[model samples]
Target: MTATAATAATVLPIRGRLRPLGLGDVRITGGFWAERQEVNAVATLAHIEHWLEREGWIRNFDLAVRGGLAQERRGREFSDSEVYKYLEALAWEIGRNGDAGLESRFRAVVRRVAAAQEPDGYLNTKFGRSGQAPRWSDLEWGHELYCVGHLLQAAVARARTRPGADDGLLEVARRAADNVCETFGPDGIDGLCGHAGIEAALVEFARTTDDDRYLAQAALFVDRRGHGRLSDVEFGREYFQDEQPVRQATVLRGHAVRANYLAAGAVDVAVEQKDAGLLDAVRNQWQNAVTRRTYITGGQGSRHQDEAFGGDWVLPPDRAYSETCAGIGSVMVAWRLLLADGDPRYADLIERTLFNVVATSPSADGRSFFYANTLHRREVGTLPDADRPSLRAAASLRAPWFEVSCCPTNVARTLASLTAYVATSDDDGLQLHQYMPGTIEHRRADGRELRVTVTADYPTTGRSGYVSRATKLPATLMFLGRCRCGYPDGRPRARR
Candidate 1:
């Protein structure tokens, strides 16, 4: 069967039910090109280059660089993680739109950075010195391994998407992964990092490299957490560790970004390992957090200090410190959870965050960015200063980028991969979780055309619906039921 007819038939099981859809069918303003432009790629690469040069994010060789890891400052030492993010961004841009100069420049920077690696396969500019610690020694704060993971993933992305792409980056990633496995195995270093990025990155690397060792290493990291194996520091030992088995943790705790990243990584492990218990835990934690602690803007981590979640209903929209990264992290968790359980509510959270908070981060020009976005506004004393300029300005569609601007590039990558979150299936049928105006082309087992044209103005109008016009044979039609309704009155009455 054709994709459209299959989709129509898939809907028949829940003809009267409502389900949410993923970004596969959702189209944001500016689309992929707009995302690239905001990140200063393709049509806007040159302009972004000029701005980055002026802002000092780029060096003499057109290599992307950042000041440091501490509170947004200038003239601090350049971080390997910062460079890795930029390389990932550049690789993504090149993958989408082939630019010889950009690709060459990216490769050159990678080579230079590779040259900085030690003979032990360790690669990081910030901590490779006589007085410094070993590569993975300082897991509590240092992001060297995390940086390597990003580089590895970026290399994989470049290799898969770009023509004539070399395996240099891939080899580097392998070496890095090997180093990590050697250093942090069960008999190796008995610790994890305060930040939980490397686990997710390692999982991606394992998938790309087809190496089970990488996957095992990722699982070990998840399993070892909360056991006091990864070290205990300023954030408290429990901050990094989930305390109980991942399945037992009831609510998201500790550093916001770290918790979410770990949760997402754990979900990845659960799905790949087919651990039903772990998946159930993830769903429980997600529902608990969203219903109680999550911001109305779909933002998490209410505290500005640790960027962690507050108590239930403790959401202070005016004083909201909803970090852009946390919003992105929530989307990642939601998307993966959606794929795991085929639940529409997960997609609902993803859509809400994407449209209102995530979309509001980048300016139209793609230069300035908002690290923190709030849902409401308040005047400070008598000065009337903007409470959350990021959200407000972004809502008004202002600047393109920001000082601590990882959020912009992060959003770019997420939007590019938005196509992956559309639909899912079990042995029974497919589920449509989101309603947007787009065509889904899927082939049915019976060799028919199952094209589904979604027609709806979601989050805007209450009466949006879908029309699945079949091309070959009449198939079953089902509605998964609305997973959520932005309107307080519940599901919008379906219009004819």
Candidate 2:
């Protein structure tokens, strides 16, 4: 037979997005932590709350509001910037619980934090106040705006997703965005954060509100990045995209989390603006960094001091301070890039990080969490004061929260948004990237419910298949094979 004819005869029809197994569908394979009833979704949230309380971080709310502080910080006590992450945690906690009181508590916190904002809509507790740190004074390490941007995003999520959730937080975010737009644009403050979070926050705000202005502001920030507008101080011009445009920067640079988050936001803008060049740049950078620079566990950023990317193939697993947040950030970038180009490789990286790096962060009980996850194990490495060794544990999971706990909630939020990354569509058909037994409801262009039933023995084995029932039209199905294509144990391949 001709090659084309032979391929056409054997190819199976694949359809629908690859949805996750959901909390309900996931049946743990081994009888270890998988068998425990406390490992469920509710239990995870409870563990998160307990850790937050134990770390004395939750009390920062009272300090921000009643204590007359300007902004939350990162220490044991209240810090302005840290408060935003705490709010993000609360938002995720509320999302997990679907609680009525949590919304009220969120609103209360928002109102108190709002009071801390100076007149001009500048809403950072640490800076932007007279007789205190000047507003927008420090862009490199300040993180004042980064914190606010996250709060804005949290507000948007709370306002839209939760039932009986008030628009108060949304209003706060709007005001904050307005302030940011007025201050940080062409005619406003000529600076950007060394930590690249606010841009993504701006894009999210725009998405939540359906306002083009927020998107425009976000684009302006992205365009002005790495052009000396944001200043180049500590790490020189190359640190925070100051050396060249994000497109020209071949390898991932600067702080690992910031670079990935910025790249993700840039992809968001590229998709919205249909900027193909920008999208291409993001994909190239992602591939180069993840494949060469990243740790075996899919963690990025080798050095601890800058929390930044190291040289290519400089992945020292033992010294791997793969920040949990960096892994989350890398996943964020990969997920968006997957949508931008329906490539299955992005999905593979996401799965790798989710199972090995991200899953290893949270303790089995879900109470404690590791700021850094390491693959290597040693007796002395487990000691309390080990200078934060990178690959020091085989699977030494920590509590759900920490003194600088940002990863647990970040993981929670990513998992909550897991539905978005499950599938993608092109002109030809839908592609299923990740396999988990679940039901996917896709509204086709012709206004039909394309119901798909996914069945598989995934992770344990590579074989998987889907059955689709479409309304009003025939659906096209496609399955991109898992990263590891061959069967385990080096046996001959088995057909599904």
Candidate 3:
């Protein structure tokens, strides 16, 4: 990976106030995130793979190939997305450091997935089979589009990291994306996904492929939302964000994960199309959510019944249902906003969520994971059985796996590519957003290069310093704490 791979970041806006560096440009050399990255690479990825195989989620792809999926499908309707997310994590880890073993595992999984694709590019085990539901039959809960979205995202990761590898994952994803565009174009299905992730994934796919059709499809999805196109559920249309137009909605509502995913996609579309109105709408929603609905730990949502957010300021600490996936979604939204607007406040919220919600989900060994993160635990939690999946989503204790295990894979992908979130570059100079022991190396568009080594024992000592050379332009390093210009030799300033 090279400095030119900055376009390979998870969220590479076509144009923004800042440019995010990719895993290639930033390296976590030591300290907090470095340790997390080490554990993620050494333990978390393998653990997820083991459970995915044990739970039969990975085998679901093989069943799809053998035409036994309708009878043998194991996981939930959305289980296929988990496999894609795992592949994405592998792509990033492999890109960061060429892991031959993980590389072999990645290609193996991709082969299984490739064999399942329908002739017309449709792929999924839960629908359009001998005994399964027809494709797109249940728009409210099918998650067919949602699965394809994850597939496209995995392909994007592969394409960026491996560029034209022989694994065939990229081709599989391209076919699926083409199918989506053709099937859901403006004249096609007027309905949008019951879930909101496909929107952002489509936009990113569009960016990756340089195809505006996918972008148009993503825009269509964003516009089609808030129109009550899908049937009302027991939880109501807001659960899917279909009750109000995205551009007109003032605050994020309904399912916390769905709300933030929709907002992140909307920001992508707005930035690509230069839709200021849409951008402002999303910004306002972020502000309102932060001011009212957000927890001090940067968690979102309170209603465990629907896994949705409560009405303005209706937070209950004991009953807080800050799903870990929702926290990741909130980071997705804020990171995009930070790049688009270059606001340090967005980074502040990101740091809070990263330290509290993201880090809190995984146990120390990186094996057990928390599906739902409650701010206060009213009861002492019994140790979950390490051998079995915990059926409880709100369990007080960390579980090795969940029946619906989205967070573990989500954490895997995020941590594998965590270095991308630490730094950004611009025409003027560089900006280091999060401080950890690391090295940031970037090349400007003009061919000049900058390398900076950061040293810190952050959160423990509240002190960090950076030494930068090989650059004539001034670098702006954002510190959440106060800055002391003169400390310990008056050369490198202390940020405390």
Candidate 4:
């Protein structure tokens, strides 16, 4: 298998900050983190293929190609998001292990996803059917843009990590993005999806294609948040993060995943546009979240009622609804923040969320996962869902899957692509964030390359190490002590 490093095809929005090593370049070859990723690749990725097929996502694409609109579309409106997320995971797994079968599956899914697209670049199985919701009709609950966001993300993942697979996924993404740009934004619909995912997706799509339209679209979406443009559905306008403008918000309110995903995209927008006020607002919101909203285990979302955030410092461990997807979203936001400002604080939060919330979501063998993750368990109990009695709902335990099933695939993609968050490099040298045993390689456009091996295994052995190999440049080391940096057993405090 090729040791493919994890690098973005184009993190253009924040390229000025620090560049990441490619997928196989930084490999978690051993120790605790490595084992988790290994399980994700072998067990979780394989299991999700079965789940997607069994759940009829793959079949829905086939039906949509024939314009049949089969019963397979019976799943949630955002079922396509799950499929796209799974493909993103597959992209990184292909880079990680270079499994030929997985690569073949990746191509197959790409073809299927492309086949599901309409000529107008509109894609979503939940719409266009006889009895289904009209296309892009409801911005509040319809997830057309959200699905498109995930599709663009999957395409970006494929283009970045699997450059050779010139299948229509990338083109499909471009067409879909063109449709989005033409359909929404200031010159078009002037409407925003209640969900916050499409903003980051458009920004990433802009990075991938070097097109300003998508970037402008991303900025428009980011700016549209918190304006009460939404109809205050479910948990009020705050649930959709439309209560205030992104630049004015000092804390993340609303559904956890939507809020964090929006915050992440806002970081991208702020970094690319060099919007100081917006950037500062996002930074302040992150600080507030870490200090006041986040749990000891690095989880967010104190309420199960809406899967949304509570007031400042309103964290309740026993009733925590810190969905695994939210934890992943938190890491996504943290990583972008890490790139935006070159802050060690972002790295600490990513490490904390990774070790506690994300790591605990998957069971010991990675065969099962958790949807709702809690820090405190009042009683050791299994989920009372009639169909899944063996599945645990909260705390450290996990379930094989859920009816919603977002968390399992989210974990799959996250763990498969975990190396991207491990280290970053600028013109000077690379900065190691989490203490994982791995080999990180960086390739410069001027034909220079640097490779470093981290023997940092403080998780199990309470020791850390690093060594770098370069051709002409010498890499310097900054060793942080256990007391200062931290012991692996304890959670580090986030700076305000």
**What are the per-residue Cα lDDT tens digits for candidate 4 across 273-316?**
88889889999999999899999778999988888899988988
lDDT of 2 by residue, 383-440 (tens): 3432231232222445334555567667655544443445544444455555655555
| CA error at residue 321 for candidate 2, angstroms | 2.0
- What TM-score would every model get versus the actual structure? 0.76, 0.80, 0.96, 0.92
Backbone clashes in model 3, listed as residue pairs: none
Sorting all predicted structures by TM-score, with the top scorer first, yields 3, 4, 2, 1
Q: What TM-score would you give candidate 1 relative to the actual structure? A: 0.76
Model 4's TM-score against the true structure: 0.92
Descending-lDDT candidate ranking: 3, 4, 2, 1
Model 3: how far residue 65 lies from native, Å: 1.5
Which of 1 and 3 is the better model by lDDT?
3
Tell me the whole-model lDDT of each prediction, alpha carbons only: 0.59, 0.61, 0.89, 0.78
Q: What would the per-residue lDDT of candidate 3 be over residues 1-496, giving only the tens digit for each residue?
A: 2213555689888889999988778888988888888899999999999999999998998888777887889989999999999999999999888899999999999999999899999999899988888899988998999899999989888888777688999789989999998899977877888988988998888888788898899999999999999999999999999999999999999999999999999999999999999999999999999999999999998999889999999999988889999999999999999999998888888889999999999988999988888888768977887888887474568999988889999999999888889988888888889988988888787989989888889868877778898988766778573354535334666664
Which structure among the candidates has the greatest TM-score? 3
CA shift of 40, model 4, Å: 1.0
- Candidate 3 regions off by >4 Å? 1-6, 481-496
